[model samples]
Target: MLSERQQLILRMIVEDYVHSAEPVGSRTISKRSEVSFSPATIRNEMADLEEMGYLEQPHTSAGRIPSQKGYRFYVDHLLHPFRLTPQELFQLKKIYVDKIDAMERVVQQTAQILSSLTNYTALVLGPQVHENKLKHLQLIPLSDRTAVAIIVTDTGHVENKKVTVPEGISPDEISRFVAILNDKMRDVPLQHVKSKLYSEIMSELNRYMNQFEGVMSLLDQIVEVEQEDRVYLGGTTNILNQPEFRDVEKLRPLLDMLEKNRTVFQLLSQQDTPGIQVRIGLENDLEQLKDCSVITATYHIDGKVAGTVGVLGPTRMEYRRVIGVMQQLTELLSDLLTRLHR
Candidate 1:
């Protein structure tokens, strides 16, 4: 526990360092914060804060900076929820509403808007198909040897891929196969399309003059390809602008880790607790990110978790503002998905 005066001095030091990115001396805090204390009194409080491990002096003559412990305490206790400015809210709403019709575009634009608003790197993990029922499927025949497989999910997500037809397959046969697949596969979750369903569909198709064996294989390939989830990342360049990342050697490995989505996905998905999660400093486990912090929130569809959205920034990030943004963004994303389902 700290005395009231010590707490005030700690808050002043943290706020000063966050703004200027510099160590704060007692005289500077007294002069800048307008605290009702003499320089000597403030210096005594600073010494007490240093003894309590909340502040650290970098050098003999230099001022003090908040330690990681101090930062954690400030985030958990001293911070208040930050409300978005009217201009910021208007910008975010405009971006989201303009692209609501297309799921990919909406998500992409959301990431861009978040990056722009926060001035930090933004990450969005794409929706998983486990809870998304198929809304529509269309097979467009292009030539004797190829066709386009278009799939739409319940959340209005559209996925299309060009597939090569098996040898010796005719256009008439392809159309017939497409019709059979549409009848059996529509309205079912993609993740639930199992090997048993495959066998049953194949058996039914084989009865049609043994013509759809090749078509069945193509359908199998499409289902397999669609099962994998995707992760979208934007604003990596924004990290370079932060003063904490001025050292290129320290920043390179962190940037490299961000490039690899699988590792990030694993890290974010591991946080199973409800509401927003904060992982700070060395707690992130990845050595490259030891000096950074991550703020994440899980977004859902139909009450089931579909994916995660988060911001990555230096440890000196504005926790209150970033947390507020993340909370609102996740809620807005959920509301958008719910409306889409309706």
Candidate 2:
């Protein structure tokens, strides 16, 4: 339990360091109107704070910086949420108003806006196909040997891929196969398509089509390909703007981790459970992110968890503002999805 003075001093140092990205001295804090102690008294309290693990003294500096434990304590207790400025709200509103028709575009644009607003890297995971019910399926022949396979989900997501047509399969036969697939798989979640395809849909396909095996294989490819998670990133280079990341060699691993879609997908999806989650410093468990912090907010469609939006920055991040912006955007994203689908 910290004394009121210690708490006040810690909060002031955190706020100052977040703003300036530099160690804070007791004299600098003593000058604040809210601080009533002399620099000598404040220095003693700071030493105590450092001994208690809330502060760290860099080499040769008589100043202190908030340790990860200090940041965690400050965020959980001292942080206060602030409302967005009218200009910030207006910028957010403009994107939704202009791009409401396409949820994917809205998500992509939202990522860009988040990075621009925070000057940090932003990643938005698109709604999972497994959560969406199958809506429609179509096969359009582009040539004798090739066709385009299209799958539409209940959430208005359209996925298409070019596939080679099996020999001896006519355009009429392809249409019939698609008709059968739509009839059996309509309204099924994408994740269950593989099991349902082999267990139930296969026998039905075998009954009418002589080339059922070929059609089944093609449909399997379509369903399997669509299951890959999509991650939209914005301002990946913005990490370069942070003082801690000035060393390109040190920043390489983190940037490399971001480039792996599967890795970023796992990082974001693991925290998609609920609310705004904060992973500070080594709490992320990834060595590449040991000096960083991640704030994630899950966005839903009609109360069902759809995806996540996240901001990644140095551990010295302005937590209150970054958290507030993420929370507001998450709410708006949910509302936009609900209204768009309606």
* TM-scores of all candidate predictions against the true structure: 0.85, 0.90
What is the per-residue lDDT of model 2 for residues 163-196, given as tens digits with 9 covering 90 to 100? 8887887787788888876888898887787678
lDDT, candidate 1, 253-322, per-residue tens: 9988987878777767766655788887877888988888888888876777777788899888878888
What is the lDDT, from 0 to 100, of the residue 297 in candidate 2? 93
lDDT of 1: 0.77
Name the runs in model 1 displaced over 4 angstroms: 32-34, 138-149, 160-175, 195-203, 209-220, 225-229
**Candidate 2 segments whose C-alpha is farther than 4 A from its true place:** 133-136, 140-147, 162-171, 182-204, 226-229
Scored by lDDT, model 2 comes in at 0.86
What TM-score quantifies how close candidate 2 is to the native fold? 0.90
List the lowest-lDDT window of 10 residues for candidate 1.
Answer: 221-230
